[model samples]
Target: MAPPAGYVNVRRDVTDQFYRYRMPILLTKIEGKGNGIKTVIPNMADVSRALNRPSSYPTKFFGCELGAQATFNDDTERYIVNGAHEANRLRDLLDSFIDKFVLCASCKNPETELIITKDEFIIRDCKACGQRSNVDMRHKLTTFIVKNPPKSKKAGKGRKAVAGADSIAGQPGGGKVEGEDDESDDELTKKIEAGAAQVMSEEQAQALIAQREKEDDWSIDTSKEAVAARVQSLDSKLQNSLVLEDDDEEGGGPYETFGEWVKEQREGEGVTDADIYKKAEEMGIAKKHKSLVVLVQAIFTEKIVEEIAGHVPLFGKMTTSEKHQKSLLGGIERFVGEIHPDLIPSIPKILMAFYQADILEEEVLTQWGTHVSKKYVAKDVSKKVRKASEPFIKWLAEADSDEESDDE
Candidate 1:
């Protein structure tokens, strides 16, 4: 993003600024709404422009920015912190900035050494060409105030090129990112689709489309109602001879299928169960479960799949048998039933483990890992991991299949 036109550009030489800075920046370790990066490194020319412009910019050091000196090496910060370990390092009294920092508006100095006073920068002190050039400090805003500057929005990082299928420039049909896939063009596209932007001849597009339509996974072989009824029928049949625990832990009536649960989620809002399942699969809830699609689907309603994702590790650990799975799900139904549907997306992974291991059976997991999953090979997860977990991996593949209908 560019700095807004009206804003002052108190910078140093842009050419010298081109050298990558190695100094660890304040708050750079933290990842929040913004990526852990601050300040646009300017070329020497821009730095010169910043140094020359002082009217709109301040000339005092406001000790708010982190020390960002031009370093000889280019390195990205790599410290990872979570929970309480990630603390606010700098004083909140003043604003702070990182690499390629703009000179302090109050001090007009380029290096980091600003002292805070009252509610604003009171004096100026230069660190490089060391100079304590202080004059007035009544009304001035620090460089930190310029964050997310209006002009900077469009001036940030340029985009990396996407595949021909995903990129707009090269494909015949605007349907997929091109060439980077491992599978044949037909097979790779079966997963997600690009919007209509293919550049191929009409003959080629028709050919590709026709080829894609033949894939069982991507084809709209079943209607929404058809799929739901199929799942419902399967559920009833699967549990037909299964015995129910006489008393529910939280004592409730019969549990609803994911379909009914989703409909009740937004009360008449029309959140199709298919859409819920599709989105969950695309976002990878399904991929994470693989062969356990039916089991996972039983637990995740579209409204709360995100929440389920947080608990995924736990769910993954707990679920191995049909009976134990339902018991754990009963717990979720108990807890989530009283909460807002929207919050279903926010459940943490830790909770998943907590709830799941509590009432889950260890043997079911052992059996699935050593038995049930052994029957089939996982077709997807193989790409990211070794083939050893193939069987356990296939369960998530079933979920993966539901998300492939669209061109995305």
Candidate 2:
């Protein structure tokens, strides 16, 4: 059967696959008192899921293009742009977003993922053609994308190895083995000495030696005696180069020391969750700020998922800003997505608890819910987290509708 007139196939070109992938047409309803009026996208979540994007991306795009503020209230599933807009106009504007953010540049297919590089450039990775096209950074959406990159397709080590091989094959004298010819020690020593002359410093020589050792691993003798002798020789050279440290500390720097301190704190009995956050601040974890999210992940275990309601105050104290909120969300993603995927069913309950405690606002949750980042977790884990949270997300949206009708 044909999809409703208000709905369209995500891959518009694939008319035959209508039933396979369909999304409702953009819908808008303007509501509020004077000066507070806003257009609400009632089905924004459904539309976003169909396009495989965060609902906030398109909602934000609408606001940016129209020069207005946008708000996505997860509690109510109310996607609001701070102005009156026609449903048809939004539907048309959505096509522009799909063209820029959704469609693959090469195949024009909608099967694409959003990738944000470390340098803050956005890339549209097409699943169909396997082409990665850089998105124009001039758009306002780029900043949001950097903060909330979509889940990427898992490219295992095999793909990376194949790519590395391809690059190597493209280089000069690419595939041929180096130093294959039998050369006498005297001649090889002369060549090594000549190469060493090009080495500018002791650091460079150390690096070179490390590289040579790595390359020689397979060819080197693995017999127990030979291995032991090689290890002893290397250990002797390393000891000669080593600088002694004070007895007060071990070999590592401040970060490692801080990590050890945190571990010690975690091991202490009768310690509360609040005590952990307080200790983190005292140890300047709060000052680092960047490390707070990582600490959140490490601090919370799978056991917390079963009792998230009690930990609300801890999360509330920890998330002092948006970055902290993002980090906390990232931590949750890792804990549930990777470590204990079986606890996926508990996500909605945890989120509601966070919401009720005022630890996370609706806007924050809505924005966080849309993204699947590998920043705090593994790629596969991020994917699993998102998959597991879908039902809870849908329920959250409908729960909003139910509350609205009751108010009416």
Candidate 3:
């Protein structure tokens, strides 16, 4: 009876229904290439929330009913099946899942909680009617529901405990000695030890020294400390295949100087968000789009959500190109990673802010989500950021689908 975007009353056949409770329509996206091709159900989480069940239940049911492999990528919240399927067909199939697992047998109400006893019995505990009904345990989803049980209130409190531990674990100083704060010192010591080991192979080491001596003509420092430093630098250069350069004398490296510039601008007046980029361009910082990402991280403080929302116009202007969109994603990854890794939970809100601002389009985000990269953050941080962004990414896909439907 209402617009179908946010919440819609399910199915047309329920003529007697007067309830205001509603559920989102099923939205699916086809993604990947060749053998990697799959149908991604983006709104499974919201639908499952409406049905009072784990998101995986209906996803697995779709796979079983469709006779295809369903994989729940928990990281991306992209519940994908191994084949392409139509949205209407999947939506109809979801009604079946609701009938079976969601609705209580006695009261026929969706206000039900799944209960599993030590005897491995699957029971639906209805809060509305106080009726307990045993669900048929024959379905494959029962085993999954048992293993991946619903998170109880007690578990919700325990999440705080986990968060506390993660805060300590996420820091670079997580595994450091109590009093040792200098990471550079530890790094230098390790490099020296590694260089000493490289000097062990008599023939190879002699050959390298001979070559260096011939090239330097003994004009360079030949002392033991100097030789060891030279060996370490050579090994570092060979490993990276590049030399590390200092910040530009003009304005300094983008990251090294941008934070101060941002602080100065934030304290000043009449500087619109786009003007920041223009200023960056004047300093040659915007020449590299990746530098924009670094500048983004430098610009924000702990209140990243508020900062991003306030600066939406700036992001919208910069994110016109695919490269800039990808860089914005990378910048978000870095900002959350170093500033407040605990803010990983706020990824969905951040993404929604960008989406509402028209900074990140669904197509660009979907393309970026299909791959995993550590170009901007560490592998672990990358994984956490990706996992945190799952819900928002899924919502974007559904929103895009709804727009397409309205267009058609």
TM-score of each: 0.20, 0.39, 0.37
Two-way TM-score contest, 2 vs 3, winner: 2
lDDT of 2 by residue, 104-140 (tens): 7777776556654332345665545766665655565
How far residue 112's Cα lies from its native spot in candidate 2, in Å, is: 0.7
- Once fitted onto the true fold, the runs of candidate 2 whose alpha carbons sit more than 4 angstroms away are 11-21, 151-408
Per-residue lDDT tens digits for candidate 3, residues 1-408, read 443455555433465445544677789998755544578888887766666566777887887677565666556676876667898899888888777776767767665566544333455655558665666555545545554566532221111000011111112333221221256334423533333222124564575455444432312343557644544543231212111123434333343344345544565543445456656665565645555565566567678887765665455444557787887887777777655688999988887666544466667777766566777666887888888888877765654554344336
TM-score of 1: 0.20
Question: Least accurate stretch of 10 residues (summed lDDT) in model 1?
Answer: 147-156
Backbone Cα, N, C clashes tallied per candidate: 56, 0, 0
Tens-digit lDDT string for candidate 1 (1-408):
443333322221233433321121123222232222222222322222223212112111221122211111113211222111122343121123211223443344444323222212222334335443322221113322221111111111211111112111111243332222343333323311431113233564576576545443422324566545644655452332121234535211112233233333335453333344443444343333222322333444445533443433334333434654534433332223222233333333323232222223334333332332211122232121222334433432332332222113
Q: In model 1, what lDDT does residue 369 have?
A: 28
Candidate that would win on TM-score: 2
Residue 380's C-alpha lDDT in candidate 2? 72
Instruction: State the C-alpha lDDT per candidate.
Output: 0.30, 0.56, 0.58
Q: Candidate 1, residue 166: CA error in Å?
A: 29
Error of 1 at 112 (Å): 25
lDDT of 2: 0.56
Q: What's the residue-level lDDT of 276 in candidate 3?
A: 69
